[model samples]
Target: MPKPTPETLARMKDVVGPKGFVDDAAEMAPYLVERRELYVGRAAAVLKPATTAEVSAILRIAHETGTAIVPQGGNTGLVGGQIPSGTGEEVVLSLSRMNRVRALDAGNNTLALDAGVTLAAAQTAAEEAGRLFPLSLASEGTCQIGGNLSTNAGGTAVLRYGNARDLVLGLEVVTASGEVWDGMRGLRKDNTGYDLKQLFLGSEGTLGIITGAVLKLFPRPQSLATAFAAVPDVASAVKLLRVADAVSGGMVTAFELVPRIGLEFVVSHVEGASDPLPDVSPWYVLIEMSAGSATAGLDETLEAVLAEGLEQALLSDAVLARSEAQRADFWRLRETLSEVQRLEGGSIKHDVSVPVSAMGAFIARATAEVTRAMPGVRVVAFGHIGDGNVHFNLSQPAGADKAAFLARWGEMNALVHGIVREMGGSISAEHGVGQLKRDEIAATKARVEIETMRALKRALDPKGILNPGKVV
Candidate 1:
């Protein structure tokens, strides 16, 4: 793509005005770097369009000028999907300026919001309406809805509420040619010939730019219960999740696996952390149950599940949070696990998923393979076990060379992904296939499946201008 010509720049500046267009290198720095600092991109300019019409105008100008466009949200993505390329030729289109809650219909349990709305803000809006937007995530405070929907983010509540894709009812997207597909359907039962919204939900902006969304909401829980349990092993934790599901009548909202190493990191790196169990165990699983009514007896239901698990030896010991403060404290440990790992030095992480039945085996096989290849590698196994998604993280061994340990990312990915494929699992369970795993998709996905994705890309974005280099 040609550099933004003076004439083109002039036209673009007029469209969004001085407040929206950012060309100074210093001012555009944040949009160029990802959260982990793993990838730093170069952009000729960053455009902060404030409205859907402004986005269309900018895209139209870019389409006419043959300039590549990289759509960014709060810049919280880990896979380098929102960052521009190193070419310093693309125009970074930021949706932060478009933040707005367009409409909220409590009666319909649907919310129409701008893409720039932060996940936390959207949740607050739903809560204000006496509803629950159950897409909870660690980065909910900073991650924008556009990027969340674009990546189909799977968070803590996937066991019950489902992923970002499941919460979305409709999306208003700007096509490659700058035309808006106003697919803002609020109806739950739409007999549509084609569910085009699904294509863009997890597309990572390769197909189009998600400008607005109509999201599904649920009734707020009147009573909630949380438990932190010590399990002997991953297999036992898996069994415990099933028991909780059965006893709670499938009301288990969140079932997270917490390995011993994860808690160790939290205790060492995080402040005001407390171990939930009296004695340390090899594995831990955080269980949460929620009910729509106060009379549902969530605590009694959790007690039954724990009793059965204890009888079956599914867990060694468990503690249910007696107060809201205790519940928040228990969750703080799980939510901060990812951040605390960074203090332990370099770490390689994989967000993969398998069948609920095979998750335990998958983790065990991958852990064994990884440790055998590299002795002293501290394997941190954890994630949303209820949905079969496990965040298999490998923290650097004690006193090891950080650089040398991090250099094995590719080899580690191959080893772990191989086991995942054997178990009929996805290489990317929650995080989308951004630049990090783009090429790996070719090897992991079937020939026809790969071709079908490429076909859709061509059909929607024949110019290959939207997020050009990321995610096939």
Candidate 2:
């Protein structure tokens, strides 16, 4: 619990070379801060280990010295799961140097990759082997696999592929006591025991540091069809989703809902972005369908679905992309929403989920409550409606003081998350319970749930030296 001593620092430097251990404030500044700029912290040193054995050795030293270790990946996490917590007593264990693709078994449909590999790189490696790694995220180009697994990220493809937890087959983790637990099996059905890998999948590095993993792969889709349809509201979007699911028979990969305000923000702020449809409506649903076979009727199927939706009054207007370039352009508008909002002004963001049946009610009720709480606030609501997850974000009114608006984050979060809980939803859907949501977890979760999580943490990490003060 005490601050690390000079002797401890010297020992850490010895475990990893001088170049591997960084203590200079200038050198450690980036690792000290988080992506959201919400959680700022200090670290005694940032240790970069090149291999799993090196990570184990560094962890052993930290464990023996009773020094807290915060495992960091690409530092692209929205929550403060990667940065130190300003205690200035902990050391950041950086996995950037551990980046490597160990194996790609096409026959087994799995890729054994180091935890430090970027999500995009892993996807590319899978593609080279004529397979698909379907865990797609907006931050795929920068976020590491370890952070993705720690957070159990859900991106656009989750409707068909599931979340990051589903894509993982096995994990190689270093526990708090510096013992490596190797469970990297590529088996599809191994009901041999307790399935311990699930414990660390979304633990946010609290129980242990995941060094590498065996990830599942799927057959690459040979054709993709994208469309943008304007719905009367969230309810209509939900109805259309049900129809699409039934029509496509599980080929509906993504179903995103965007508000008019969200699209306006993207068009106005993001360069080279334009409206996907000829006329805009109050709400829009971006749908994507893919098939592994070389099928030419995907476009025809999408068009038929849209025509039926129009006839049923489930959609107000729709546009189906005729070419691949046009399809990419349509998706670019949806992908650039978050960045455009950031460029516009200070925004309060929430990544929450509810039951599919309650999603429409949650969105409508939360929008009304939040607008009432802060008049003139621009509600930029959009996200994976098919999975009941919404990025219900709110931007301050133009010309409003940024500091003052951001100061009300807690109030806004309470208003939105309260509705989510009432609808039997989660406060943090894909993002894990990092430092940002620790207190929120205490407030929102049942006593038994919190107590059970704490018990698991205590059982796996008795000394509590691994990523201390995170999650439970």
Strongest candidate by lDDT: 1
The 0-to-1 C-alpha lDDT of every candidate, in the order given, reads 0.92, 0.89
List where candidate 1 sits over 4 angstroms from the true fold. none
Q: Residue pairs in steric clash, candidate 2?
A: none
Q: Write the per-residue lDDT of candidate 2 for residues 1-472, one digit (tens) a residue.
A: 5678899888878878887899999999999887778888999889998888888887788778888899999998787988888779999999888789999999999999899999999999999999999998888898899989988989998899999999989999998878899989999999988999999999999988999999999999998888999998898899999989888877899999989998998888877888877876999999999998876588888888898899999998888888888888788888888888877789999999999877788888999999899999999889999899999999998889999999999999989998988888999988777888888898778999999999998998887888888887
- Against the true structure, candidate 1 reaches a TM-score of 0.99
List where candidate 2 sits over 4 angstroms from the true fold. Answer: none
The TM-score of candidate 2 is 0.98
- Please give the range of 10 consecutive residues that has the lowest summed lDDT in model 2: 293-302
Per-residue lDDT over 246-326 for candidate 1, one digit per residue giving the tens place of the 0 to 100 score? 888889999999889899899888889989889989999899999999999999999999999999999889999999999
Cα shift from native, residue 451, model 2 (Å)? 1.2
TM-score per prediction, in order, is: 0.99, 0.98
